[model samples]
Target: MVLVGWGEQVFRAGLKGRGCGVDEGLRELAAPFVVPDPSGVAIRTRLKQLTAVDEEVLRRVGAHLGTLASGDLKARCHDGLAHDAEAWATRKRELTPLSSARWAGAITRATHEQWALARRCALAHLQSLQAGVHALRHRLSLPLGQKGSKRAPGGYRSRREWHAKARRLRVLEDRLARERAAWQAGRVHVVRGGKRLARMRHQLPAAQLTELQWRARWEAARWFLRADGESGKRYGNETIRIGPDGEVSIRLPAPLAGLANAPHGRYVLTGRVRFAHRGTEWADRVAVNRAIAYRIHHDPVRGRWYVTASWQTPASPAVPLAAALGHGVIGVDTNADHLATWRLDVHGNPTGNPRRFPYDLSGTTGHRDAQLRHALTRLLHWARTCGVRAIAVEDLDFTAEKTREKHGGRKQFRRLVSGLPTGRLRARLTSMADAMGLTVVAVDPAYTSKWGAQHWQKPLTSKNRRITRHDAASIAIGRRAQGHPLRRRTTPPRAHRSDVHGHRIVQAGGDAPGREGPRRRLPGPRTRSVPPDAERTRATRTPTTVRGVRGEQEWVPDSLLLTD
Candidate 1:
């Protein structure tokens, strides 16, 4: 626990101070304050534990600081170049996690499997800021034309060009507005200062260094006890002893050896676990199995202790797309609140009744998880009933798309984006569907909603039923997966008579036949023998002429004249 205490103190101090990274903080401040290690914990392990805590704080703070910078720059850009440049210069030194300390601390202490997570977050945010700067600069560089009360003769583009420039300016204006909003709201913070940690404590059970280390131990409990290339002796091995009454004892690693001698040794470092159906197989392979890894964990919610064992399993055979499509497919439309699904035959025709399974995500983590589980269960059950071996869904990603919404997008749209359960739903569906012997097919999401609404909506809707845009989208998604054309076939319209003599026209409408306009009759076949002989003698042919209105007239030739 000494490492935890020291780490927490150092982290708090680092946040208060201006300089020093994780390594510098450790060497300059925390390394000097080492306490007694009576438990035989190595210096290396202690340092690692401390580093993990500090790294977490840095990662979270860095991410927010980058966002803070971007927001400031955007706001400044809106006012003027001078203001934008000034703010950009100042943000490098001024941004910090101090503004929202409780939220910052809570986020920094969130559970992460790796220390590199913080660096990744910081880098990602920085890159995003750079991209925004480039885009904004490019937009600002365009020839937007002069703005004035009166138009100048040659100073502006045509109406079309002017409208396009106006559109670009409006887009830039909206982006800046979003940035300002993001800054005002402190984009990354979960909640405000007072009573925040108290509220999040349950969600974050292992925020402290000691608790974190314990959690790590449980996670890493499964380790392969093997030999070196030459010595054939295992490192980090535990001496396991079994009693006559099926009791078990274990001598743990150096850091945990003191726990082995503690009063709660059995509960802390060792405990008995039943093997169940694989008991005999495990017993037989105790000394024979090349790989021997075991893990033990406690489910805080269930109040139960369980042991886990791992073994390599063979890979499942790959199912070809063509083969899977032979059995028909289930088209799924993932939405913010529910999954919309429909079954389609091999020919892309809807075969069964559509289903909608709703789920609530605006709840506790456990509650959301339970809701998702129930939804997936029902969807899969229905899929099984339909006897479709393959399911088609949109390959979607919203992170980058939604990132700017928190600052620049509409409030309703932003809320909808935030509440979308796309990622988690996709992951859960894939694994569960696999376990139930079904194939998951991902298709392009482009124009599915538009095409679906345009073609499928009215057809799917009826006197007794109303089809939603998403339901139509689901059908579109399935059809796209099966490589079918989005447009439906229609019978050709009948031909219509035209104003031109002896000619017909193909009309698009189903209107009744009627005189569109006055028609002109063609002249009878011409007699040319005498006229040709006279024209040959003249050595030239006269051109045709037409009469004018108001009794005006023009000359005409026999072979090239109009008849009255």
Candidate 2:
């Protein structure tokens, strides 16, 4: 009888609705490739020791620019699909009187980016709706309680479920239609202060915030104090310039120019700033007057002001896969709470003990981000210690997996999938690894966990070293990245075993002498015997065959045999 383990059953169940094909319970896997280096870098620092006058000037400038930006965004949205270069120029000209030419340029650029982002988001939503509708229709078409294969989900389990799913299908269809219409019309829904924050306005008590605090946060979030860089300009920025000595100055709007503390209608803060991280790179860029964009924003909860400096870097040449795997790799399996990692050699063999770097993803967003960064820092340090030049990770995207329609009643599983931080982990790890002179290899995430458990889990586990499914998955990931098979090498067939077939495990190379010959005999007793010469004695005195011809043999038959 065939026995199925609980883990395997769970894995098979999870494959439902994954759009798997009929191919031996396997999904198409993408070839592994080295992830390219990040094309941009951003470093942030806080503005400290600001005077009351400085705060007043900053607030005034931010508020004035925020109004202009809001108006520009509104106009851009109104233009919709009909927007063009002439319309963009007209908007910038209108804002130039209220703000400076550079400020107008920044606002227009930001508005265009935000609008484009909204359009992309709308398209994604439409796609998601279409997927939901398709899945619901397929499942509803099947008979109730019908079993599903690994390739697709079956019908609902009961009449109640079927009815409920039928309602959901209609709702999804309606949503899909609306989203498709909006997409075709080039209309997108975007909120300036964020849709989540906008909704929090109705539940201030639930959010544990007073009306005044909410208003402050709202206005702070909407403020636009960003400026793009011009290579020929001072410090590579014209509007918001930070000198080599950390002196920050902003070109105030035309109306707010009267509040300028510095010459040329510019406002210079009493506070200075320094980026603790990537300070040398930032300084190098500033010294040479390379283009660097800057953004000033306020954190209402902390009541602190901060400035971010960002710049684009030239794209690095893609490293060949062979070169990246020369020094082996560290495969990392990202989870909701911790990272499961294993170091592997270039031959795709696990080199060291499996390591787990645990991080708490609870609390605020900043806390979660810090936790992730701290965990990754430890991982990178460990990788460097291992002398590996590449880190392998599954190219995971939980976008389709996180939907309620796809996962159904598995709320916990859905939450776990949604909380894996796949995108953030990839981005952070790629940027960090690039800085550390390491490459990241993203392998197909198709069946890492399942195949790892089946082929690697038990074999690698022992009393002293216990390998979890995630650790096994890390091994599989590393192997996959290195172009190795997931499953272990099969043993030789029974007909190819023992001395008759020469070797039991490995076959000799064709160039090997006597490659097809039987194994050489060893000088020892085959079993518990009288002496080591038993083979010679048996060969010399083992004539047990009786020689009898028909004429010479006596015809002696027993009486009992005759009677029978």
RMSD of each: 25.1, 12.4
**Candidate 1 lDDT by residue in tens digits, 106-129:** 222231111234334434454444
lDDT of 1 at 126: 43
lDDT of 2 at 148: 74
Cand. 1 TM to true fold: 0.48
Tens digits of per-residue lDDT, candidate 2, 216-238, equal 99999998899999897789998
Off by over 4 Å in 2: 1-25, 494-497, 501-564
lDDT of 2: 0.83
**Colliding pairs, model 1:** 178-407, 178-408
